[model samples]
Target chain A: MYGKGLRALTLATLVALTATFALVVFWAPNDADQGFIQKIFYVHVPVAIVTLVAYVVGGIFAFKQLRTDDRKWDVRSYVVIHIALIFNVVGLLTGAIWAKASWGHWWVWDEPTLVSFLIVFLLYATYQPLRFSIEDPERQARYASVFAVIAGAFVPLNFMAVRMASSLVHPRTFATAEGGLPGEMMFVFLVSLVAMSLLFWLLVKYEITQKNVTWQIRALRRRLLGDDAVAPIGRSAAPTIAPEAAKPLGQRPRVSYENSPEARSRGPEEIAT
Target chain B: MRSREPRPMRPTWVLLRKDLLLERRAPESVPAMVLFSITTFVLFHFGLGRDEVEGSLAAGVLLVTILFAAILGINRLFVSEQAEGGFDAVLLAPIDRTALFLSKAMALFLFLTLVELVAVPAFAILLLGPSPWDALGGLVVVLALVNGALALVGALVSALAIRTRSRDLIVPMIGLPLLVPALIAASRSCAPLLAEGGASWPAAKWLAVLALYDLVFGLLAYAVFDFLLED
Candidate 1:
């Protein structure tokens, strides 16, 4: 089911990304003030927006995972966070490149937006370590959800605090690319946002489908070569698929939570290592 | 195993009392916190090589000292619980499980207050430029709210790191970053009070931020705690 819309989403993303790249190089007007140096805005701003939105979306998925105690939602949440971290790195790199180009510094504390994003990046960087430290899948899922929820709420608060402090001290507005965007620029920016968001979704979908396929392959090996043939996974941060779900291609009962009662809940699949 | 869950605060009080009694009998966390504060004060003196610290510098020293000492308490907070199987006992108890969060937070708050009692005086004698008398009254009120927020955050971090193998390392890594907004608020509020001219009242906005943090995380932790304890 996760892979069902893959072809369409991938095609759309490819079209959008290509179009965005071409438009940035050709059609989008140059900034009157910052000039050619401002072109980085096309890549940086959209990636930043998508990353923040993806983190919040990850939190929402985590909330649903908690409410339903479903591993699928956790997987979705994990995938979102994983992808967002990658985008976050892109945002930081592009930001640094922009900063060095404009301000002559690789980093600047004067820009609250950039500083706040750094803090957010530092905070979310811990998500993986926290997940890896806990070996139990169920507790890991639950605790990780709690962290995701808390960190999600913390994001807006951190931005507000940093913004307030910076504005009070510097009294200088480091206008983001969106501020006072002209009609032509706004059109280009909106297109870039769409393109970046599509690319994000496509990558997430591809990752999930890839995970699903890996699971199915493992199921096949278990059936064809017997259980003893498959070596086990060691302690890991990745969400464990329910054994029934993982074993289906190998002929195990696929009594999923969708149809099962609450009492039918089972412990997480064996590590088998 | 929760059964006939009638008493909530009663278990909370009992647990608080138990932790207090234990801390009193052997004196594990609070004493070490006091000592750590005094030592860090000495370190700051040599480290910064400043005779009289004021304004943001003073605020930074005090906040860092308190934050680090609080980490000491937080690191040890769940030790008794984790080592003694207190979590198991709590789950077996018929009372509400939320009491655990409340009691742990309360215990942490009290320990923080005790640290502040000593650390404030030490900071005054050792490094403070403005007279302690100038802002003592207002600072306490601001700090009470700040302490409340830290207590909630400390407990959440404690619960988070307790079950992990690298709890000692994880606590500070997770906690210090999580405490950033609180740090921003507390240090910013304290800066004006510790400024060179004279100790003055803290701005109301920082206190509001602290209060909002407490309210938000207080509810967030309570809601998610049961899941953390679930088997």
Candidate 2:
């Protein structure tokens, strides 16, 4: 399952993302006003949008974990949050760099761009500590669900508060009545957004598969070492044959046989005879 | 061990009375809030170069200082509750949790408002002479809205503090950013009234935003208070 899906999705996302960037940088016209630096918008805006999308997905998984009490959803939510954090940091850094090039300053505290990034940073930073502080799995998931919902609610509120506080230091979508984006730019932007979303989904699937495989291996090892004769397939079965060479020093020797449980069920005297 | 009897409001009132009585005995929280307000007002006066025209700035400065000091007092109130194990007793009560939140919020609001009442007049006299009493109506509305918002946030933070490390530091870290919008709204609303004879519409709009924030968070905190207090 992981082999097929991971390869296909990763290849598809890479192709799409490369094409979108190529279109944005080479094919799209330079902004009438902001010139070459405005190209950063193609990356920054899409990343920002995807960051929000990732967070909402995380919150939905969190809610599902609460309702179903499923550990899968918890893993999904956890992985998605890490992905979201990556996108958030990238978006913030690129925005800062763009702001410096365009506005001649690295930071603008009053601007919505800076304020929204700060809020997202603070909200996601709380997730790790909140998770670590709790000892019980179910209780940790429950509290985290509540915190995720609260954080999700606050994100929009913080956005609105910053937007309402004052005029933007840089142009904002709301500043223009229709948020005038030329058709070509809008198309490329939409493609970039879709590509990022696909990439996020693929990464989440990869992490979940990795976790599932790791658990499977651990369970197999446990069964191989245990005395129980009930050999569960796919999980580790007790080594049917005890290898004389592999036995550790100072350990008891046991009868060695493979394929037939009958030979293993016999006494050591019968096997020696 | 159980007996059937009528349980009255006595427990909640007892809690409220205990809090008030403690305040009455110490007299420190309220006085400190008031003194903080005065000191801030004095600093503003000196910074504004003692110009009577600067009364508007004084109103904004005085109100913010009083609010910050009130937060200090609220943090102390919850810290004392944790220290004495009084919070557990309150949580064990049979009364509705909303009542507990409401009663505590009201008490803190009253205490903070009392400090504000003193601060307002002292601010007015020290900065600007007595003016039209009609503006007092607007002031009352702004104060009620801001104080309610503050108390609601304070209660939520207090609950968080009990469960987190560095209880003192975490409460303010979480609470202060949430308070910024309300502060901006209240200060803007009060500035025009204290400076000129009329209120600005923009200021009134900000006051409305403050009222909305108070209503939304107030309901949220009340609903979640029980979960927060659970063992």
Candidate 3:
């Protein structure tokens, strides 16, 4: 089911991204103020917007995970954050490139939006280490959910604060607020937004598909060669599924701590009850 | 069990009292935090090569110093819970888990206050070019709000990182960036107050930002703290 609509989504994203690139280079008019340097906005702004929105959506998924105690949501949330982190890197790189082109410098803290993005990227960069550090699968999922929820809430507040601080010193150039983009530019921007969003959805879907397959393959290997043939997955930052989820009904799923820290600290009696 | 439970504030008080008593008995976090701040101020003196700093320089130095100092306390915030049986005891108790969070934040606030009591005047003596006393009232308000932010954020980050192996590394990496908005609001609010032209009241809007940050993160830490304690 994870890969069900992946093909269609991938196709749609490909078309949209190609169309976007074509329009940006050949169709859209140059900005009166920024000239050709504004071309980067077509990709940079959309990627940034999609990255931020995807991160929030990841939080929402984390919330769902916490509410329902569903590891599926955790997997989904992890992928969303993973892919969004990549897009965020793209957003920052392209933004820097655009800044270098528009202004003389590579980084301009005066650009509050870019500054906020940097802060946000730095924050989310810790998510992996946070996840990787905790070895217990259940505890890892739960703690990661909590972090996603809190950091998700941080995005908008951070933007507002940094923006307020910067606006005092410089005029708002990136303020795509009212009367910002003209007609054709807005159209192109909308197209690019759609493209980036589709790309994000496609990436998340593909990641989930990969995860499900890996779990299923692990299950298959254990089934064919017996549990001893398969090694316990050592410490990993990636989310792992219940062994049973990877197998069909009526098959018994083995539960072993193997060399886990949880096994060492917890007495067998403590673990049983 | 819920009916027999002590009221929320009661446990909060007990926990706070326990932390204060522990600090008084052992003196682990606060003394280190104060020493850390004063040491950082000296480092800043040599690092920046300025005998005296004013305006933005003063604001930057003060905020950065207090921030790193707060990191020390945050790094050690949950050691007792993790090392001892405190986490299990609290989970076993009928009292809400949020009491732990509320009390820890309160304890952190008190420790920060203690640190500032000595560190702020020490900052005034060593590095501050402008007279800190000139803006004493405004500085107090800004520092209080900043303390609120640090307390909430520190408690939350401590919980998040407590179970991790790389805790010492995780504390500052997670806590400082998470503190940017509050940092922005605090630094901006303090820059004018610390100006040599004489201390002036900061823009209320910046204060509002700090308050909002504390309120939002306070509620957020409350909501999410339970998951960290789940067995």
TM-score of 3: 0.92
In the range B1-231, model 1's lDDT, one tens digit per residue, is: 778766547999999999999999999999999999999999999999998899999999998899999999999999999999999999998878889999999999999999999999999999998887887886797678778878998999999999987889888888888888888888888998889988777888887887888888899888887777787
In terms of lDDT, the poorest run of 10 residues in model 2 chain B is: B195-204
For each candidate, what's the DockQ? 0.74, 0.17, 0.82
* B1-231: candidate 3 lDDT, tens digit per residue: 357754549989998999999999999999999999999999999999999998888999999899999999999988998999899999998898999999999999999999999999999999888887789999999999999999999999999999998999888988988999999999999999999879888999999999999999988998899888989
TM-score, chain B only, every model? 0.95, 0.84, 0.96
Instruction: Kindly report which residue pairs in candidate 3 clash with one another.
Output: none
The TM-score values for the models, in the order shown, are 0.92, 0.75, 0.92
Worst 10 residues of 3 chain A by lDDT: A264-273
User: What is the Cα-based lDDT of residue B148 in candidate 2?
Assistant: 90
- Candidate 2 positional error at A87, Å: 2.9
lDDT of 2 by residue, A21-114 (tens): 8988899889887898888888888888888877878878776765655555666677788778888998899888888888888877756866
Ranking of models by lDDT? 3, 1, 2
In terms of docking quality, model 2 is incorrect
The candidate scoring highest on DockQ is 3
* Residue A92 miss distance in model 1 (angstroms): 1.1
Worst 10 residues of 1 chain B by lDDT: B1-10
> A170-248, model 1: which lDDT tens digit per residue?
3132355456667777788889999999999988988777776677687778788998998877788887664244445
Candidate 2 yields a Cα-based lDDT of 0.68
